[model samples]
Target: MSLPELLLAGFLLLSVLGALLLSLPIAAEQPLNWHQALFTATSAVTVTGLGVVDTSSLSLFGQLVVLGLIQVGGLGFMTCAAMMMVLLGMRLPLYQKRLISESLEHTSFAELAQMVRLVVGFALATELAGTLLLSLVWMPEHGVAAGLWISAFHAISAFNNAGFSLWPDSLAREVADPLVNGVISLLFIVGGLGFVVIAELANWRPGRGLSLHARITLHASGGLILAAMACVLLFEWDNPATLGGLEGLGAKLQAAWFQAVTPRTAGFNTLDIGAMTTPSALLTMLWMFIGAGSGSTASGIKVTTFMVLLLVARAFLKGQARPVAFGRSLSARTVMEAVAVALAGMLLVFGCLLALTITEPGQDFLGLAFESVSAFATVGLSRGVTAELSASGQLVLIATMLLGRVGPISLGYLLATRKTESLRFAEGRVHVG
Candidate 1:
């Protein structure tokens, strides 16, 4: 098979294995049926937290299996496989290197080994630190054993931008807790800022500057978080089911900030997502669609794509020849790729929504749209519509999650594949409004 086909097949094989394991009697209090097992496995493999059953319904072994799947999924299994090869001191063949580079959205084959080491090492170290810090908060309430397990689970989940939580309400009880709010949000934020940016930050020194890509990622992430936070605060401030119920400025701000951060495809929620006003819900969907950095655990068209769209529009309005940032001009190809990603993402979400309407005609349109975007972006935040959907509707989401996770990368591969053209076509013009 070609590299892209191989790459996609690997994920599928792993998801199937996960499904088989999850279906075993040991995996759940009551063994899940094949479809349920497959759906859960796919969601876990995609690092999208949407689930048909409560996580707590799973036995200890089952939860661990899910956690393993999350780690493998969050850091692509190819990276894990390559990391194993590195540990064994085996040379990466050209094909293996190509697969590793493709998985990470990286361009350098020579750096694959080093990048793999860094990615795995950083991920484990960061997750360990998160576990320790979170333990301090939960240990006093729940005993050491339970507290530690919870901490470990959430730390891994947050850092992976996989919003799976043991609690049904998903950190709502800690909405006002400063420690919980701070740690979880920080984990996802750092995780969502793809490893490329992380590696740059790690090696950064005085007198050396970040690349244009890193700069735009950092600036756009911060800008989006702040903008979303402000908008959530404004739109939900008077809604008693959301921000208005909070006691003080600190609590409200914490929840608002978290709500803003989660929509960048993290999927954790401090407030009642289904209870938020229509405006806040719409805003959240927009951010969910934009998502975080490229090659990050989170999925969507990615923050850079959204920023490029904005830059392109600004240039058009100003009558500039090209979109430029940080004194560097974006090539036409780059701009066209950005537009393509955005349009494709929109169509993906639209297609899912259309499918849901057919399978679930009685459901609210807005809720269905929110669920469709959530699934396609792999954001996992639903408007409480997930459980209500019929099996067919859920199947539509299962496909969406799988496709959403791999679609962009696969699309990139197809576009980048060289195709010989024997002749040049004549220029054609079309009029637009």
Candidate 2:
């Protein structure tokens, strides 16, 4: 098996084992069914945040198991394994390094070890900072110990874009607290920005412009976040179900901004997502589907794919022969891969949506579609179907979450097994419409 595939398999296997372990009486008051355990395990390992049951209801032991799975899944199993190998004073086998490279989406092994070290360091630093900031807001409500745990859990969840909240209602209760909202939102933004983007920004040298990849990621992600914020504000400004009922204009704006930013894979909701207007929901779906950047904990087709597609379209519109971005010509192969990834992702969402609609015919189509898209994108913003999905519906979401985590293209690669070429095909002419 290819290194990526092996790594993914190992992760799935570990998740199942973890879930089984969590199902023991010692882990929970009530034993969970195999399906429930598998689903929860997959969701946590994938960082998709779709829970079949209320996470807050789980025993402390069970919750810790889930949190551990999220941490392993967020950084990737292979990545953590590599770190462990390094800590043991063992050199990573060339094969293992290649696997690590694929798992982290790096192009080379030149600095693979350093990159892994950097990823772990930056991730821990950001999460710790986030926890300290959030503790200031959470400590008054909960005691020191509980507050510290809450802060740490949320910090890891936000920085990893895991979206598993300790509160049953997620972060909706904190909408009015500007400090909490601002800190969490900042963590979400930083996490969703992709590690490579942040690393490049951190090591950026003055007078040496950003790399093409970094530039595309930054511009596309920034544009989408701003556009989503504006659209949410415009569509829900007067909607009572969402931000409209807030007492102050500043609170409303803050809530809108937070909602717009978090849905792009962080999955933390500061407002009633189910109460959002159809237009706002639709806009949020778009943002989630175009999610964070490639190689990040966040999923979806990725910001880079959307940016590449846009560049391709722009080139075609201007009658240019080649697609170029930031004065760098994009490889044809990259454009094709982006198109393939997007097509595969959309197909998966559509297929899952169809299955969900059939399984639950009485539910709202828009709501079902939203849930399917959320699962497929690994964005986790749902309109309350998560707790209500039937066995079949849950299975559909499980498949979507797996595809989202492994990537649609990666799954396709596994299935296809081999690429086909045609050099002797006869060309045929057809009439234009």
Candidate 3:
């Protein structure tokens, strides 16, 4: 099958699995329908945090099912399948290799199998370290087993940028807990940093330098995170509803930092997101739209795409013919693709927002728009509008989440695979402004 077909099939299979799991007697009390199961499955698989139902209410088995889906989704279905195939002594076909490469966002097929192994190993190591640190923080309050489970679940969720929380209010209730907030934020930052960059950094030699892709990913990601932190701090510094009323400097700083980092496709939030002012909410919407790196579990158009678009704008302002970044020239195709993706993403968000406005007429426009963008980008931050959305609004969000996770461009590619013939027509020029 083609890459698009493979992805769609994988999504469908995972959705079916979730539905089946939810149908089991132990999992049936909170019985999920096809739409809910499909939405949750896609959200987990895409590492998107938009959920039609509260995860905390699910039974242990159901929660485990969600966790399992997250694990498979974070690694990509094809990668897991490829590994299984290898274990069975089955050689990967060229098409399968290509599908895996695209799924992992790798540029080439060379050493892909080895890369998959490294990816899984590195993911586990990071998740384990995060879990250990989190467990230390949670053990005193919740005791050993409960703390361990919370730690492990959160570690996986944070590292995967999946945002599946055991608590209904998410990490908001633990905002004052420095250890919990700090550890979770650290995990989120590490996870949001693309896997390729991590792998490259791990294998880096003293004299050797980072690859171009690694440098771009790191620099762009760092710049965005720092900017987001500054923006959120400045915007919410005096807002009594958010960071203003806090007496302790440490708590305010921790909350600000956590909020800043989490919006970049990490769904955990220390502050009550719904209480933020219009300006802060707008800033968050922009951050959510930009999101994390390409190959990471984090979604959105990606930091690289945002950077490329900025470079393109800069080139135009400077009267340059080509866009350049990090001492390297960007190709025309790259710029075009970036523009297309951004435009498509914006349109999707706006479209969903419009749908939401009609469905949830009483909702705040700004908050609804922010929620729509968050869902479309798979960033999962909300202005407390998600739980309050009507059934139609929920359906709109579900579609947006799926489109965001699968990607608008990928969906377009899937829908129209046949290339149109370019028959040369009579050349004509029209006068323009």
| Clash count, one per candidate | 0, 0, 0
In candidate 2, the residue pairs with backbone N, CA or C atoms under 3 Å apart (3 or more residues apart, or in different chains) clash, namely none
Candidate 1's error at 361, in angstroms? 1.2
Sorting all predicted structures by lDDT, with the top scorer first, yields 1, 2, 3
Q: Determine the C-alpha RMSD for candidate 1 after optimal superposition of all C-alphas.
A: 1.1
Q: Which segments of model 3 are wrong by more than 4 Å?
A: 23-25, 28-38, 408-433
> Which numbered prediction scores highest in TM-score against the true structure?
1
Tens digit per residue, CA lDDT, model 1, 248-333: 99999999999999998888898989999998989999999999998789999999999999999999899999999999999987
What would the TM-scores of all predictions be? 0.98, 0.94, 0.92
Tens-digit per-residue lDDT, 374-408, candidate 3: 88877777777776776688778877876787774
lDDT at position 219, candidate 1:
100
- Estimate candidate 1's alpha-carbon lDDT, on a 0 to 1 scale: 0.91
Better of 1 and 3 by lDDT: 1
Candidates sorted on TM-score, descending: 1, 2, 3
Query: Which 10-residue span in candidate 3 carries the lowest summed lDDT?
Result: 408-417
lDDT of 1 at 179: 89
